[model samples]
Target: MTGANKQRVDVAIVGGGMAGASLALMLAHFCPHLSVALLEQRALPDADASVRLPSFDTRATAIAAGSLQLFSELGLWNQLRDYCAPIERIQVSDRGRPCGMSMRAAQQPRASFAGMLGAVVENAALGPVLHRALAQTQTQVLAPARVNRVRMVADGAQLDWSAGAGCPDTQLQAGLLVVADGADSPLCRGLGIVTERIEYRQRALVTTLGVQRDHRGTAYERFTDAGPMALLPLPRRDGSHRMALVWTCSEEDAAILRELPEHEFIARLQKRFGWRAGRIERAGRVSDYPLSLSLAREQWRRNLVLLGNCAHFLHPVAGQGFNLTLRDCYGLARALAGADLAQNSTVGLELLEAYGRDRRLDQQLTIGFSDRIPPLFASPGLFARGLRQAGLLALALTPPLRAGFVGQAAGFGL
Candidate 1:
């Protein structure tokens, strides 16, 4: 509702969550001359010291070594270091089975190539840090703005959105449209992009827990009949070791566990996860998310590209969801940097093709691996169980195999 009803930019990003914010920042840092706009329905929360975000309230994310390097290159890692808990080692095992495999960062040939294997950061901490970094950039941010429609014009694409905070209902035109919306993306649906989906009939129970003993910078992945349970390390607070818990199980069981008493819930988790990280003394708020694989059959159009969960929703078995998206955004940034924005439509097509070609292999490898691992562990059949055990044994006995696993976990596929 203002004088300037339209805006023109070189790039327009929909959904200003972790992935969208990241792409905007990358473009700002690497391709400063390009005009970029980040459209978000939710307003960016203040990154001040006194603020606490509901999104960051009880969740934590594992950032692979490769992702950390990208943050470092953008000069934002220093802001995030204080909130990060480094993961120096990882242990994976089948519950009640003797077969298992472990990897230590120090055992790698180039131990310090990327330092620690990975790190964990609470969402409460990560969101603001990213928002602050975005604030430092020249990218125009349209928060509390809902996209009403998207039209592919002759030159590029045009977006119409209504903003809150007394802002105008504006229009945006850009050569490139980067859709980083989450899994249930309306934009993706409107664009007629189909998703190949597989419902796993499982729900992930996510919470933070206080451990009796130190986690020692180690992350644990315990596969059981219920599903895969991951205990990722978090920094100690008040001398208590904290670990992020992701336990997957049936929907009925998840509903029961979510309603159980904290002590009782921890007890059940302990019975399944064992005492690897010491006694599970207490738990924070528990939340559950349904598990499914949603992969967009087409990632790009003439002037559009999809990123993050909208592009591919993984099982989260190996904590590769966000990491893989980070790599995709990285590739897009590199591609855009070399393209000519003056020839909007032609360059947009060129960038989309080049970016898709460069990212296809990595996407296939990561998505295929994520899809396969969960089923192998979830199967209760004797042959499946035996295969799981044998695979673990092989991983333990073979150094090159172990190295490949480590590389994949660290965000570098074999």
Candidate 2:
């Protein structure tokens, strides 16, 4: 009903997932005078309930040091701190190799919170936290809304959408349009922005596992012949040590693994990951996603910008997908905060251009690292295997290089 009459805002975000919600918050904090609108397809559950968007499912994301600082700057870190589990150590190993590299929080000079490498927060907790924060802001949120059409007009972009179930169709006008609608964004396609996607021929199987021994704030990344298996630390209600598992494998192998019994699944997982974190006591629901490196050929158009997975989707190798986007959101917010919007209804081209230019290096590095590293470690070739093991050995032996790597992983490379 609210959209029945044309509503005008300075920024209209098409998807209210992490990136979109984050941008709304950033605007609310830094540019409170600017009117903002967010249109989301999924409706939030009742206040007491916690059903979350599929994008923000049960999967846990590794929050880098830089991201934590950014959240703190935005006054959001306190809200998320309770749900986070610190990643104090990371052990990277090859399945058949004799040696591996261990990155400790103490090894990096800048590591904070008693040498915390990073932190992990489950989506089930994060999504609601974000939505609640959005609710507290002045940004208008329209959920369970279906966007029927988007048109680029001379003044700005116009959205024809219907809010809620059986709601009447309404129109909205915005000076700038932000598309954070994930990788398969119809809006991006409609705008003739082609995606360059490289299929890795692998699928990521994700689940949470209860361990017999405490994880001790350590994350393990084991590179097996099948693919990479990463076990990130988590906290359980029963005071049990939980680890979030992200295992990459061939499609056929993934199919087999997904159907295996809990006991059998844990057995197989232990074989690949070893007894580093001790025996896996139990397994949770398993979910799988196809792995790919996808980038939008064009991220910006006149009065329009794309963010997050809509702009680029990276392999989950380093868990850099969300981290990179968070940085992008921060940059865009800074650009908007400093720009003079009084002269025009929409943000100026100069501001947009500068923002794009600023993000180019970070995007290229993050995307390239995610794209190249997975295959190098996952490769079955003898040369690739040797290279990976040797690289790990060198990293272990070289302190300066290791510190640099840690800094990069902390998202300080940009």
Candidate 3:
């Protein structure tokens, strides 16, 4: 601890993933007067340009339109535009049903161009982009730093951490603390935060595939007998039509599928995905993630506030986890920038309550979708399937309702 009169940072953000880095950049770039420091444990992100996903990690997140707008406002969507694939239409269906429910761009009131519902990018691509932006900002990046201790007191929040390999720990004091750590956040737990978590006995197998028919910016969400599967289009870089696949199934089935021969796995996927995209020629090495939903009782405590997966972790089936985190990050930045800095820190009860107030409904709505979809979509009985199919028909046949659903998926509903 510095006994000298050293200046304290206005905010110290822990974890430099998309949520942390994006928010840090916003705060530093817009309100540079507010001293902000971003702490990341990795010495550095991988520097190899040839490696897209790197080995062992193969997940991709579906970026929603609202988030894309937020990124656009931050002047980042343009940077990612070429790298991501636009989703022009979404087809939600019950495989056993008679037909599919489609929410198309033409239904919207747009005068020109299909209102892109959203875009999909390799998450591997996202980390590097945000990290690069973070590096460009004046915000201090504590590379290879670990949080050894965190203390929140009446005075302020204190963080003890070690930077560089084999180095002594250093202490930092901040008027506000941001916990942007992932799903299993130690900082939140260390502060005795309560979270509701559900472990579905399923795992999602994700990968990329080359298809015969062009995706034509069409994305498919199919409820299979085994589980739910989504096929999202990716923008072609080399005149090649590419698609990203997310297949959810029982854990045992996922393990078995992962072990199958490459051709065998592709065949299985083809049968489930059908001939809409023609032959499913190739499949990347699969990525597996256990499905779950986690929600922290409170997004803030004392001089501390939680954001991103640290605050709420949703089922990937809904693609709402990262989108929600981005919203939280932007909201936090907005809330901080609007407040009176002389009389209050960004970590005060009033600020926390205000953030909670503005965001609670949105969070709840997304959570409810994640919590509801899996069970309903995963139902085994014929009667349940019949009911779901009927709902799909309703959605497809009803123009106003279909547009509303499409708007939500496109990120325009909010």
Candidate 3 local lDDT, 54-170, one digit each (tens): 322245678877777777777677667767877777778777668777666666643112377778877777887777767667788887889888888676788888886588778
Sort by TM-score, best first: what order?
1, 2, 3
Q: How many residue pairs clash in each candidate at the backbone level?
A: 2, 0, 0
Worst 10 residues of 2 by lDDT: 48-57
How high is the CA lDDT of each candidate model? Answer: 0.86, 0.85, 0.77
Q: Mind sharing the TM-score for model 3? A: 0.92
lDDT string, candidate 1, 244-305, tens digits: 99999999999999999999998998888888999998898899999999999999988889
Better of 1 and 3 by TM-score: 1
How much is the lDDT of residue 364 in candidate 1?
89
Among the numbered candidates, top lDDT falls to 1
At residue 166, give the lDDT of candidate 2: 78
In model 1, where do residues sit more than 4 Å from their true spots?
1-3, 48-57, 109-114, 165-168, 343-346
Better model by lDDT: candidate 2 vs candidate 3: 2
Candidate 2 lDDT over residue span 259-317, tens digit each? 99999998888887889899898888899999998999888877889999989998888
TM-score of 2: 0.94
Candidate 1's error at 287, in angstroms? Answer: 0.8
